[model samples]
Target: MREISLDRLRTLVVIADLGSFAEAARQLNLAPPTISLHVAELEARIGAPLLTRARSQVRPTAIGETLLLRARRLLADADLALDEVRRQVEGLTGRVRLGASTGAIAHLLPQALEHLRAVHPGIDVQVQVLTSQASLAGLREGTLDIGLVALPQVAGKGLEVTPWRRDPILAYVPADWQPPARVTPAWLAQRALILNDSSTQLSRVTNDWFAAAGLYPQARIELNYNDAIKSLVGAGYGATLLPQEGEAAELDRRIVRRPLRPGLWRQLGIACRQEQVERATGYVLQALARLRQ
Candidate 1:
């Protein structure tokens, strides 16, 4: 029997997913005849019918299902191997997959990325916006190389989560409101407020600040997107509490930044596997360290 072709196996998977030979061909940009030929060749190699068509749908047979499972794994390994070799040939040393929240991505990660581009140009860092829970889960699942997460994460097996930075949270209010120089929980909680949703760590921290002051004021609105929340504050919808990450976080003319009295800060952590870091991943980590304050 001849060695199975990767291209033919891919065509089979695509056909099964799309459920039409023509659709698969269009999706794969292969001629219809080629798609048929691929299936015929695979079936010939295994000496069994791989697909059976009924009423405009193509279904894989028992043997085909078995092969499909193995084919998927093989294809993933092949892609990773190809990427590894291509990186070497293309003057790239490593690829690191990093995950963090949108707010961190907006302010904190830019500094790290800039450092990497200048100092370790050969290392490529792929950034994904994810919640702290999702980022930690991805690290544990071996899908992420690094994670910038909200602090206070429970340390898990085979993972090290350490504090990276602590940025003070500030109150963002409308410029026209003529608010005081410093914002106190008691002062801001009395007026209309927009806050991070209960899901975020920032929201919990702010809620605690209010509770400490013997106040439990409800927000006029709660949202996850920090930028959009700031926009609403700019429009005089209400005030919000958000972290002033790295340097000066300036909004527009309609909004003003005020420091929180009695001091509240959002702490961030960098997480990685317990195993020794690879060179590329190390470079990425070093870049992130530059961002620490």
Candidate 2:
């Protein structure tokens, strides 16, 4: 039932950063005893020792470290909330934390951010590469303001999902290698194949495609990065299934991309907290839409 004081939480963070109460007090413009009292009050409220005092340094206990982590996030959110209010009054100028998959980061975000930067120079966008599931978890935890993830994602409560684009999965082979007009699972099975690792949703979809055709290809190599897979394929290592995206001329010259017989595709979408669908987060979605157009 006791509410932790923001001032005391901030004091705890400063001490953790400086590793000395004296330094924390100097930085915070408070006396050493005042800093110590702030920490002590927090410890008394939490019923745990927060710091270990040594000859010259102070460190947080395990429980203190845990609390410090939460406290930092809480403090950051509070700061961002104030910043958001100021930005709303002074035009668009706030931070948007975005989580996305590797492909989305490599192929999509650059263009989206380019458009966003030109339009809203004040808004700061922070992007992290993460799997769809991890991005979803980050959205739920309030760590990320928006997510660009593969579609067919389970839209549980509190999320607003918008389908963005559908990228067809294509087979990348050596330029010199000749293949059917429309590649088939049977055709791919006859040769060694470079594949996405089993951890990815793309790999799972590819596996199902192979299963439906009653073919299990020899996986010469499994990697998580599209560029790596393309490099290997270009070096005559093996063919791979990858989303169709614009590539560099060097990669384009080395490999030939072909569509599959049945046409497999991966759908990508944007997700955000339902309540955040109309704020700075929505600005990002609008930028992405412009890129699509």
Candidate 3:
């Protein structure tokens, strides 16, 4: 069977409302013959007489009334679907996939999320906790829209890697241990240590820091997540070095954070495929920029 035409359906609805073919034509800005033909074709397709001449005012047959009810709903739904697509095309609403480390997700992403919610509530950001290398791979493979990655990156072709922020690496230790004003590789080396696994960029950075001072420290346990490492430090399991994310409102009373003597700083970059940047992604990029320090 041939599919029903929406234009013809619209004509049926208008003619029923006006009760006159001439008035429907005037309202639709169509010729009178075109309005009559529209209804004629609809009735032919449905194999039923849709309209009738009752005294003076034109009215719909029982079958016509059923189609009119369904037509109104279909037209309304079609219009709504088009409007949503328009909003997405205009960047007023969309979904963006983002990748970042667990540390950034915990300390940094919430502020960006809040900003996005206030400004572009219709934009949905899907986040994935990934290593810096994995984030870059995702960008290359077209799986991720944006990545918050540890720096010293060489932006590949079509990729934009921009330095976003710098944070100092600090020593987190049991608060009960009264240590020096500043932590050095030698001092930290002597204590029981918790370190990020060798697979992480932070692990490499920390290892380099220790190696520079002619001290190669061994970790009592290896873990990747920063929050978990902090918890271990609070429990006096060991001390670990991690980036100071921001001026935290509440300090963990059980664990004390102290700056490194050599002032080791961690650099992070905002990475994205230049060609793949959409309007919604740009909005999220702006939100992340607000955290630049």
Candidate 4:
């Protein structure tokens, strides 16, 4: 008997997921006949029928159910092995996908990416700007290799999040608009407010701060992104809240950020599946470690 092939195992896994040979073939870029032949060969090698077709729906047999679990593990292991070998030969070459929360994407990630690129030119870093929920979802679904999100993992429960940085949340006011030396709930309520939309964790936190302060923002405008909020504030629209690090440059002229009187900070960090840690992530982890220093 011939040894079962890795390709056959992968094909079976895809078919099992998609529940259609044709769909699996499309995904693998293989002809339908080729996929069918590979599955047939795999079944013959094991001396068990792995699938039964009825009215175009293919169901895995009991033995196939058992094999499916193993096949998935084998495929995952094979991929990781290949990733390791490629990294060994090329020295951090290949692509790493990362998702960043809106705040991190605008401010923190640029410096981190620049530093990483300067040190390791071979690695290709791909960044997706997403909301915190979207970023966490991407990390869990394998669509992202790593992600930077607000700490506490609001969206997904099982991520391995390491502290990247602690940014003090500051109230940003257009230069020349503030009279109060410090922010109070009453002080905040009296000001014209421009709110960052609800898509960001920061926005939600800011909203809660309002609730805690017994002040409801009379929001004059709401924007989904940081830049837009900044632009509006610069135009004298209203005050907005953001992290200190993210507003450092804006702190120079158009905007002035003051620490909330009570003082609140948000921890931002990189998140990965505990099991997906690899060479590229090691570099990211190293970068995150540097932030702590």
Q: Provide C-alpha RMSD values for all models, in order.
A: 12.8, 12.0, 2.5, 13.7
Over 1-293, each residue of candidate 2 has an lDDT whose tens digit, in order, gives 87998889999999999999889999999999999899889989989999998887899999999999999999999898988797865548778899987777888788889988898888888999888888888999989988887777896889877888888899898878897888999988888899988877888889989999998775989988888889899898899998875343446577888899999998888888888353566677788887552
Ranking by lDDT: 3, 1, 2, 4
lDDT, candidate 1, at 167: 89
Greater lDDT among 2 and 3 belongs to 3
Ranking by TM-score: 3, 1, 2, 4
| TM-score attained by model 4 | 0.66
Report the Cα lDDT for residue 138, model 1: 95
lDDT of 3 by residue, 148-211 (tens): 9998877788888999999988899898887799999898999999999998878889999999
Lowest-lDDT window of 10 residues in candidate 1? 85-94
In order, what lDDT does every prediction score? 0.89, 0.85, 0.91, 0.78
Global lDDT of model 4: 0.78
Question: What tens-digit string does per-residue lDDT give for candidate 1 at 1-293?
Answer: 47999999999999988889999999999999999999999998999998999998999999999999999999999999999888755546778899998888988888888988987788878889888888889999989999998888885899999889998888899999988999998889888998888877788889999999999999999888889999999999999999988775476889998898888999999999999887788878888898887
Lowest-sum lDDT 10-residue window in model 3: 244-253
Poorest lDDT segment (10 consecutive residues) of candidate 2: 245-254
* Best model number under lDDT: 3
Q: Residue 87 lDDT in model 2?
A: 82
Query: TM-score per candidate, in order?
Result: 0.70, 0.68, 0.88, 0.66
